[model samples]
Target: MTAARAAALPGSEAPAGDERLGEILRALDEDFLAVLGWDWERRVITWPRQHPVIGLPDCPVPGCPLAITVSTRPMCGGCMERWRGSSLPLEEFLLVPKQTSRGTGQGPCVVAGCGRPRVTVAGRLCLAHHVQHTSAGLRVLSLEEFLAHPGVVGHAEFGPCEVAACYLKAVSGQVPYCEAHLNRLYRARTAPGFDEAHWRRTDKAICTTREVSLRGMPERLVAELLYGLWVRTREGFKSRPECLRPVYDRLRARQVQQLEEVTDPAAHGHGREQVTMIRAGSERCAC
Candidate 1:
């Protein structure tokens, strides 16, 4: 059948919810159907829908979610994949928020309360305050823009070495360090070393060990064992000494309790035989 006739036939209509139909129409007008060897109206309408738009339309860079126009040549996955190695103008596609003025119609300052032009991540202060303030509030810089700044130096916040540290900064979009350092400090001070297998084993042993003398076995020893084991594990190895302090304190308290019972015969005597039997069994079983 003729292209126009084919295009008008039943089922030769655009699918529902296809917003790009206008673009498709433009393509058809430009002989796209002729190039694909299909009747313009029929083929265009009859083409089976295969792919759906995937992922958010905004920039995938962490902390950035501005809806960038597809036609404005926004940075896509391919661009981001090679972003570090190349110096392409990816920032050109970045969507900058519009600056709002005060009721007086004057741009007082980008930052609240401060009457200064916002500083770039590179520590570039406005000409008026450039020499006056060396250390100002933290500047919000893009990954590329931050790299381009002369004074903007990257600091490592986690991992075994410097490279791992830099990788964290690159991924987190934070200024000085990544979130891992903060998490490590917080965990160290607040959370106990819960992942050490040896710690758990020793804890179990301490709970079950029954010899009256052994019953009063130092809690410090158990704690030390836990801390040591934690250090040996991957999580422990990464943990700072401060993070291990709580574990140390817990074990120390246990040691103190054992010592107290040992010194006071009355506290530990009644359970002595039972404790002994339990300890004997534990030793035999290698628990």
Candidate 2:
């Protein structure tokens, strides 16, 4: 090795002009990078809500932005209910102007020991807790006093939802599905070719996260990704999956089979800096 290259080696001090990243990457074996990268890849497999590949489709109404809680619904729950109540025909009713504000989904109840899904935003309590709070004996209880001594707790989770892709907990121990999937099951019961067994495997997950999938990515691209992922971690740079997601998407979009094929590594959005670092490492590699 040349004097500058030798100086940048692991045991030696890196010279001022030498970018030590090259030497650092050179020291990491292919096997090491591959194993670490795959581990990180698996950890990031939980796809984010509204992810282009795995996310649930939104309500189909002309202006509705809310996601369809039930996959079988033609419109949002609110719009569906409104249409059912109106005497107007489907086409005419759709034409009528209606305010469309996307809904913020409910969360677990506020009571200290309660984990039931809250009934409404205002109540911030599950149906069971709401009933108890409204009863004559409990009417005078202060919010603080009730929170401190909330009687009888419900389970935080029954189990992971039955759908293979779904990560949300089931609605309750007795319920076979989460609330969203339960609604979907009822609506689709009579639909032609609807089968619970197949549905369990095919249903999309319905939760928010920052994860992504590396499935179907070409081999060479995965090689580059793994190598780059290792290099970034070694360099004290952030290796967030959300940040790397765009890099993976763009490379896959271009059908990049090899790292050398990436002519403009700076163009990958969000993770441009990370890709650039990867490109620099690729250049240093003889392979």
Clash count of each predicted structure: 6, 0
True lDDT of residue 125, candidate 1: 34
Please, what are the lDDT tens digits per residue for candidate 2 over residues 19-47? 43344344445554333333322322432
Best by lDDT: 2
Candidate 2 — worst ten consecutive residues by lDDT sum? 40-49
Q: What's the true lDDT of residue 25 in model 1?
A: 31
Q: For candidate 1, lDDT tens digit of each residue in 1-287?
A: 23554346344343444433322232222232322234322221111112122112444444432322232444433344446455555564333332321111012222223333322322333323333233343245553453355564333322211121111221132322223333443454455655432222222111100000111123223222322222233122222222233333333334443211333233233233323332232222211
TM-scores for every predicted model: 0.18, 0.38
What TM-score number comes out for model 2?
Answer: 0.38
RMSD versus native structure for model 1: 29.4
For residue 45, what is the lDDT in candidate 2? 42
Which residue runs of candidate 2 sit more than 4 Å off their true CA positions?
1-106, 120-123, 139-142, 150-156, 207-287
